[model samples]
Target: MAVSFLNRERTIATPGYSRWLIPPAALCVHLCIGQAYAFSVFNLPMTKLIGISRSAPGDWKLTELGWIFSLAIFFLGVSAAVFGRWVEEGGPRRAMFTAALCWAGGFLVSAVGVYLHNLWIIYLGYGVLGGVGLGIGYISPVSTLIRWFPDRPGMATGMAIMGFGGGAFIASPLSVWLMGRFATPNHVGVAETFIVMGLVYLCFMMVGAAIVRVPPPGWAPAGYSTPVQPKPLVTTQNVFVYDALKTPQFWLIWWILCLNVTAGIGVLGQASAMSQEMFRGRITAVAASGLVGLFSLFNMLGRFLWSSTSDHIGRKNTYFVFFALGTFLYALVPYSGAIGSIGLFVLCYAIIFSMYGGGFATVPAYLRDMFGTRYVGAIHGLLLTAWSMAGIFGPVLVNYIREYNVTHGVAAAQAYNVTMFVMAGLLVIGFICNVFVGSVHERFHMRAVEAEDEVEAAPVFGGR
Candidate 1:
C-alpha cells in the first residue's frame, strides 16, 4: 500500500496543475547527484584516512582512487542503458525514489568502507550503487520535462541539466567545510562527512520525488499549437527505443556527442594542471583553481543559454556552432600559450567549456527532433553510452599524450600543443557527423495501430 503512491497512475498531473513546479523538482535530484563532479575533493582526504596527517604505508594510491570516479561514470552509462525502459514505464516518481535510495545508500555504505579502510568496499558502494542512482536520477525528469514543455523542449531540458553542471559549486565548498567541522587529531572526518552528506541528500531528493508529476495525456500548454508544417529534421512520428539503434542518424549523433565530449572532458579534468604547466611562473596554483571554478560557471550557464538558443536556431545548427567554433578555439589554445597571453588562454578554454556544456544540453532536443518524443528518455539513456566512453577516452588521451611529450623532453608549456591539435582533429570529425544527421527513415517509426495499442495498454490516469 505504501509503495502504490509511487505508481505511474498516481503521478499524473491533475487539471490546473502548475508545470512550473516540475523543473524545481528535477533540480532537487540533479543538484544532489551532481556531487559526482566534486568527488575529487575527497580523493586527497581519503588517502589520509589511516595516517590522518599524511599518507601511511597501507594508504590507497592516487591512481587507485581515480578509479572510483571512473567506475561511477562507467556504471552510470551501463545502468542507464540497462534500465531506461523500466524508468520510462515506471514514472518519474518511482525512478526518482529508487535513485534517492541508491544514492543515499551508497554514501552510507561508503562511510562504513572508509571506517574500515577498505578501498574495494568504497568502489562497490559509491562507484556502482551511487552510479546507478546518478543514471536514474539524471533521466527521470527528462521526458517529463519534455512532455510538459513541448513548445520549448530545449529550454526545458536545459533548465534541469544546468543543475548538474552547477552542482559542484555547492558541493565543493560544502564538502570542505564539513571535513573541517568533523576533523580531529586522529580522524580526517571523511566518514562523518559522507554520513552527513548522505542524509542531507536523501532528504532533499525525497522532496523532489514527492513533488514531481507527469502531464496528463493529450495535454498541451494553453493556446500552443503543433506546427502544421514541421521543421526540417523535426519528426511527427515516434521510434521505438530499441529500433532507434538501427538508424544511421542515431550512430551519427552518437559519434557527434562522443567526439565533442572527448575534446572538452579531457581538457576539463586537466584544466588546473594544464594551466599551471603551460604558463609556468605566470600561473599560480590559486589562479589555476580559480580557472576551474570559472569553467564550472561557464559550463553551467552555457547549458541553459545555448540550449535555449537551439530552440530558435535549431539543434543541428547549434551543434554545428559547437563543432565549428569549438575546433577553432581548440587550435587557438597553443597560440594563446605561445604568446604567453593568460587572458587569451583562459578565454579560449572558457568558450570551449561553454560549448562542451551546450553539447550536453542540446542533444536531448535533437533526439526529439529525429526520433520523436515517445521513448526519447529511453533513447537518451542509450545515447549516454557515448559519455561513458568519452569519460575514459578523454582523460587517458590528455594524460598519456602530455606524459609522452614530457618524457620525450618537450617543454612543459609546449607539451600540450600536440594534444590540443588532436582535440581539434576530433572536433573536425564531430562536425562531419553533425552534417550527416538527417531524419530517420519512415520504416523505423511505430505504426498508428501499434502506437495506439501501446498507449491503451499503459494509459495515463487523467486521460480516462
Candidate 2:
C-alpha cells in the first residue's frame, strides 16, 4: 500500500493549475543538486582540517578526498542510466522525494564521517549515495515541464538547467559563510557545516516536492495547438526509450554532445591557469578568480538565453551557431593570447562558455524533437552518461596537452595554443555531426503494437 501510494500518478490537473509553479519546483531541486559543482570549495578547507596544508594522523589527504566527488559523479551517471526507466513508471513526486532523501541523507551521513574522520564513510555518504540523488534530481522535473510547455521545451528545460549552473555560484559563497559561522579554534567546522547544509537542503527540496504537480493527460494550455507543419527537424511520431539508442540520430547527437563538452570542459578546467599563463603574469590571482566567476555567469546565462533562442530558430540551427561560432572563437583564443588582448580573450571564452551551457539545456528539447515525448526523460538520462565520460576526458586531455607542451620547452603563453587548435578541430567535427543528423527512422519509432502495449500498461488516472 505504501509503495503504491508513493508511485501514484498525478494525471489530473487541478483547477487553476499554474505552469509557473513548475519552474520554481524544478529550480529548487536543481539548485540543490547543482551544489555538486561547488563541492570543490570544500577541498581546500578539508585538506587543512588537521593541519595547514598537511595531513596529521587520521586526516584525509587531498588525493584520498578527491574520490568522494569522482564517485558521486560516476554513480550519478550509473544510477541515472539504471533507474531512468523506473522514473517513467514512478511519477516525478516519487522520484523527487527519493532524490531528496538520498541527497539530504548523504550530507548528514558525510557529516558523521567527517566527525569521525572516516574517509571511506565520507565516500559512501557523499559519493555513492549523493550521486544517486543527483541523477534522479537532475531529470525529475524535465519531462513534466516539457509536457506542460510542449511549445516551449527549450525555454522550460533551460530555466531549470540554468539553476544548475547558478547553483555553484550560490553554494560556493554560502558554504564558506556557514563554515566560518561554525568554526572552532582547532576545527574547521566541516562536520557541522555539512549537517546544517543537509538540513537546509532537505527543507528546500521538500517544498519543491510538495508543490510540483503533473498536468492532466492530453492537457494543453488554452488556445495552444500542436504544430502539425511537416518540418524536417520536428517529429510528430513517438519513439520508445530503449529503441532510441538503436537509431543513428541518437549516436550522432551523442557524438555532438561529447565533442562539445570535451572542448568546453577542457578549457573550463584550465580557466584560472590558462588566464595567468596567457597574460604572462599580468593577470593577478584575484583577476583570474574573477574570470572564473565570469565564466560561470556566462555559462548560466547561456543556458537560458541561447536555449530559449532555439525556440525561435530550430535546434539544429542553434547548434550550428554553437559549433561554427565556437570553432572560430577557439581558434581566435591563441591569437588573442599571443597579442596579449585580455578583453578580447575574455569575450571569446565567455561566449564559448555560454554555448557550452546552451548545449546542455537544448539537448532535451532536441531529443523531444527527434524522438518525441513518450520517453524523452529516459533517453535524456541515458544521454547523461556522455557527460560523465566527457567530464574525465576533458580535463585529462587538456592537462596532458599542456604538460606535453611544457615538457618540450614551450613557453607558458604558447603552451595552450596547440590545445586551442585541437579544440577547434573538435568543434569542426561536431559541426559536421550536427549537420548530418536527421530524424529517427520510422521503424524505430513507436509502432501500433508498442502504443497499444503502453496503453494497456498505463496506470489509472486520479487514483488515490
Which prediction has the highest TM-score against the true structure?
A: 1
Candidate 1: Cα lDDT at 55: 94
TM-score of 2: 0.96
Clashing pairs in 1: none
**Superposed model 2: Cα runs more than 4 Å off:** 1-5, 52-58, 452-456, 460-464
| Tens digit per residue, CA lDDT, model 2, 1-464 | 65564553643359798989999999999999999989988987888788744567656677888889889988888888877777765667778889999999999999998888788888999998999999998888888889889889999999999998988988999999999998877889889999999998899888888788878667888888887786778897788888898988888888898898999999997999999989966998899999999999999999999889999998999999999999999999999998889999999999999999999999989999999876788788898888888888888899999999999999988999999999999999999999899878788878766665664454543211
Task: Count residue pairs with overlapping backbones in model 2.
Answer: 0
**Clashing residue pairs found in predicted model 2:** none
Instruction: List ranges where model 1 is wrong by over 4 Å.
Output: 459-464
Q: What is the lDDT of residue 76 in candidate 1?
A: 90
Q: Superposing all C-alpha atoms, what RMSD in Å does each candidate have to the true structure? A: 2.0, 2.4
TM-score of each: 0.98, 0.96
Query: Please, what is the whole-model Cα lDDT of each candidate in the order they appear?
Result: 0.92, 0.87
